[model samples]
Target: MSTPFPSDETAKETPASVSKPIKSAENASLVDSSVALGFPEGGFTAWGTVLGACLIQFCGFGYTSAYGVFQDFYTQTYLTNSTPSAIAWIGSVNAFLVLSVGVVSGRMVDRGAFYPLMKIGCLLQCLFLFILSLAKPDGYYQIFLSQGVGFGIAIGLTNIPSIAIVSHHFQRCRAVAMGIVVAGSSLGAILHPVILNNLINRRLGFANGVRASATLNSGLLFIANLLMRTRIPPQLNAVSYTRILKNSSRDGAYICACVAMTAFEFGYFFEVFYLQLDSTLHGLSEGFSFYSLTILSFGSFIGRLTAGVVSAYVGIPNTVVGSLLISSAVIFAMIGLQSAVSVAVIAASYGLFSGNFIALMGPLVSYLTPENSHIGARMGIMFAISSVGSLLGAPICGAFLTSHYIWWKAAVFAGSVATGGCIALVFMQVILKMRQKASSVCSKEAGV
Candidate 1:
């Protein structure tokens, strides 16, 4: 609760009463372009940053979105000895590291270490995927090292900072810009499967196909390195990372929001991870199963924009609730989709809704924090915490499978978990609104 403006003049004149100077050396660079700093909102530099970030997202999240195909392949061919649940951990580990290591990368971004992180991320992402191409059919450990650990670290370093830099360029359209930037993943989702299917199923075999994808990635990372630039330097020592965590954790609303985010992430990738498996089980052709991911990605691309634009009218948290609620229903309905067409429809709908939900994840972290300066660190901490869910969700879902591959148990688990996340979000929303109302009343009384 807000402490009312002190009862007496002297109490009101305490350290907290002192207004922070706007143009101080520390935060002078942190000011917005539109309101004060005069940076162009939609100029070439700004749009370049967006495009650059899009490439990074496409490379990182979008490329990995195809892990389902790989998971199925490893189970069916390469690592036949390993259980589907074990194979699922490789992808889960990737998702885990991508988010969990944000603590390091996020700190670096706050301290103007963007280029260093990007260079490492770009190199590691390319190098490890190539290394992955060398692993043997039973090389479960090798796959985990290269793809799950190395690639996850690479994306962790690269992804959040990529989108954060875009915020440096656009102010009013920042949300929309972020939505478009994230939509890059969906675009990648659409393109990578076509590229992979051509290579894996049609032209080259698994080994050669991976090498080809790695080669393509080197070029994309080059562009990303070129175009992504930070608009202004952060104020050194602006806030201690520890202080931000302690302060934020003390807030009931922020804690509730984190719980909500964790729940959503827990079930987020289950759909992507199992989409192909389910399609193949339903008697769809191999090509059709692969193409289902493309359909989902296409829908996600549209969903990202839809959520961003709609949130502009309603609200971000509210949009998350509504969209997640719809997506959760689609996820449940997907359990009954015996035909390719039914699978496509559910995949598309889920993509649209889940895309918006994904786009808002970073923005919502920034929203929940008390200080804008702490966004990167707070986001890092938040993702690290939530990555626990992403890390375990798949394994848990996989364990529910039976010997017969009647995977309805996994489907039910995914949907139910997502619905639980939505419930947490609702609680968070109520708490946040109530706190804002309380603070406003306290401000009014002080003024009187």
Candidate 2:
């Protein structure tokens, strides 16, 4: 409950008996106490939470981000009997789970189960990673069970909460904090591949390398659990899912953002999943192609940070609309890349613009929310809807290629979808402005 305001008795007595400076001090104390009940905004503990959330992203989605390297290794060394498409299902399922599980995990966060969920999720990830270390060579089902399904579910449990937790500690600085947190995945993407490739290819074999990585991740996750803390008191009263959905459905801005998220995700993974192969097909060296994802990820790291800072000044909606348009243009430009330099430049450019959506999405959801308490459930619905695109987008892009890869077909398809999402973001922005204007007009007419 909010703190009570000063009573009318105090106001009456202040003018007659209280000194001016004393009255000012009383008002200031009240304001400070009220603000304390809400977001801390910035403090040592709040930033510590951001740091811990970053580690969660590093250990969770970071590994998933490097799945391209894993896929390449499996296709060549261990899982040769399985068709590339069949093996691709493993990564696809993992991606789907990472976002899809938010449907339940998000609600749990709202109900004040953040720590329990984090602990369980981190444990599950370590457990599955260890189990993944034991799978025999050419054992497709074993890998699928341990790495694909088991690990995916584990990451899913923590994925939404990592982003949602930031809402508790930050209000004004939230955009930048979320960006920094999500940027952890980019750093992980860059580093994990180097670790996996060197250990698997030159030093330890697959099983031992996975075990080593799992040990390292366990330590990091332990640190994250200790560092992260929830600031908001959870609502104990149960809220109906049907009521939340019904309210969200009536929101034009929320619906548009959902559609935009789904469409943006539909095309977002095309470069991430296929860039190395596409570079190789277009005549880039195998060594360069191998590092293509790393380069893209590095660009994304910078891009996410930049987007976060810029959005604070320009506003989140403006930043998102600009990012969508630029990203769509970059995807379209990919069709013309012929030389090694061109491929590298385009990959970096695409990463720079595309990274904006990742950083701003959490803040965008919070902006659209009518109540702070609804942030978790609304974010869950958004992620679950967008997971559809993540699950299917890559497979559909792969289908566009013949036995000999025709990269342009996929490029054209992906670009067009991103453009569609861009248009929707613009529409969402317009709707938001209209609603604000209408609300302002009503307030003025009511003489408030």
Clashes of each: 0, 0
On residues 340-405, what C-alpha lDDT tens digit does candidate 1 reach at each position? 889889888988888787767666776676665566566666667788878888888888864356
lDDT by residue (1-448, candidate 2, tens digit) is 0000101111111123323232332233233112224466778888888888889889888898787776667766788776555666677778888888867786677566788899999999999999998988889998988887899999988877887788677776765676678777888888887777667766899999999999999999998888887755454454566777899999999999888888787677777777765676677776777787888788777777787688989999999889888888888887887878877888798778877767677778878987755665677677788887777776676667534467788889988998999889988989999998999999999996
Model 2: lDDT of residue 23: 31
Please report, in order, the local distance difference test score of every candidate based on alpha carbons.
0.75, 0.75
Clashes of 1: 0
- For model 2, give the 10-residue run with minimal summed lDDT: 1-10
Error of 2 at 276 (Å): 2.1
| Top of the candidates by TM-score | 1
Residue 216 lDDT, candidate 2, scale 0-100: 90
Q: For residue 213, give model 2's deviation from the true position in Å.
A: 2.1
Over 4 Å off, model 2? 1-49, 136-138, 164-179, 229-233, 281-283, 312-315, 433-448
TM-scores of the models, in the order given: 0.86, 0.81
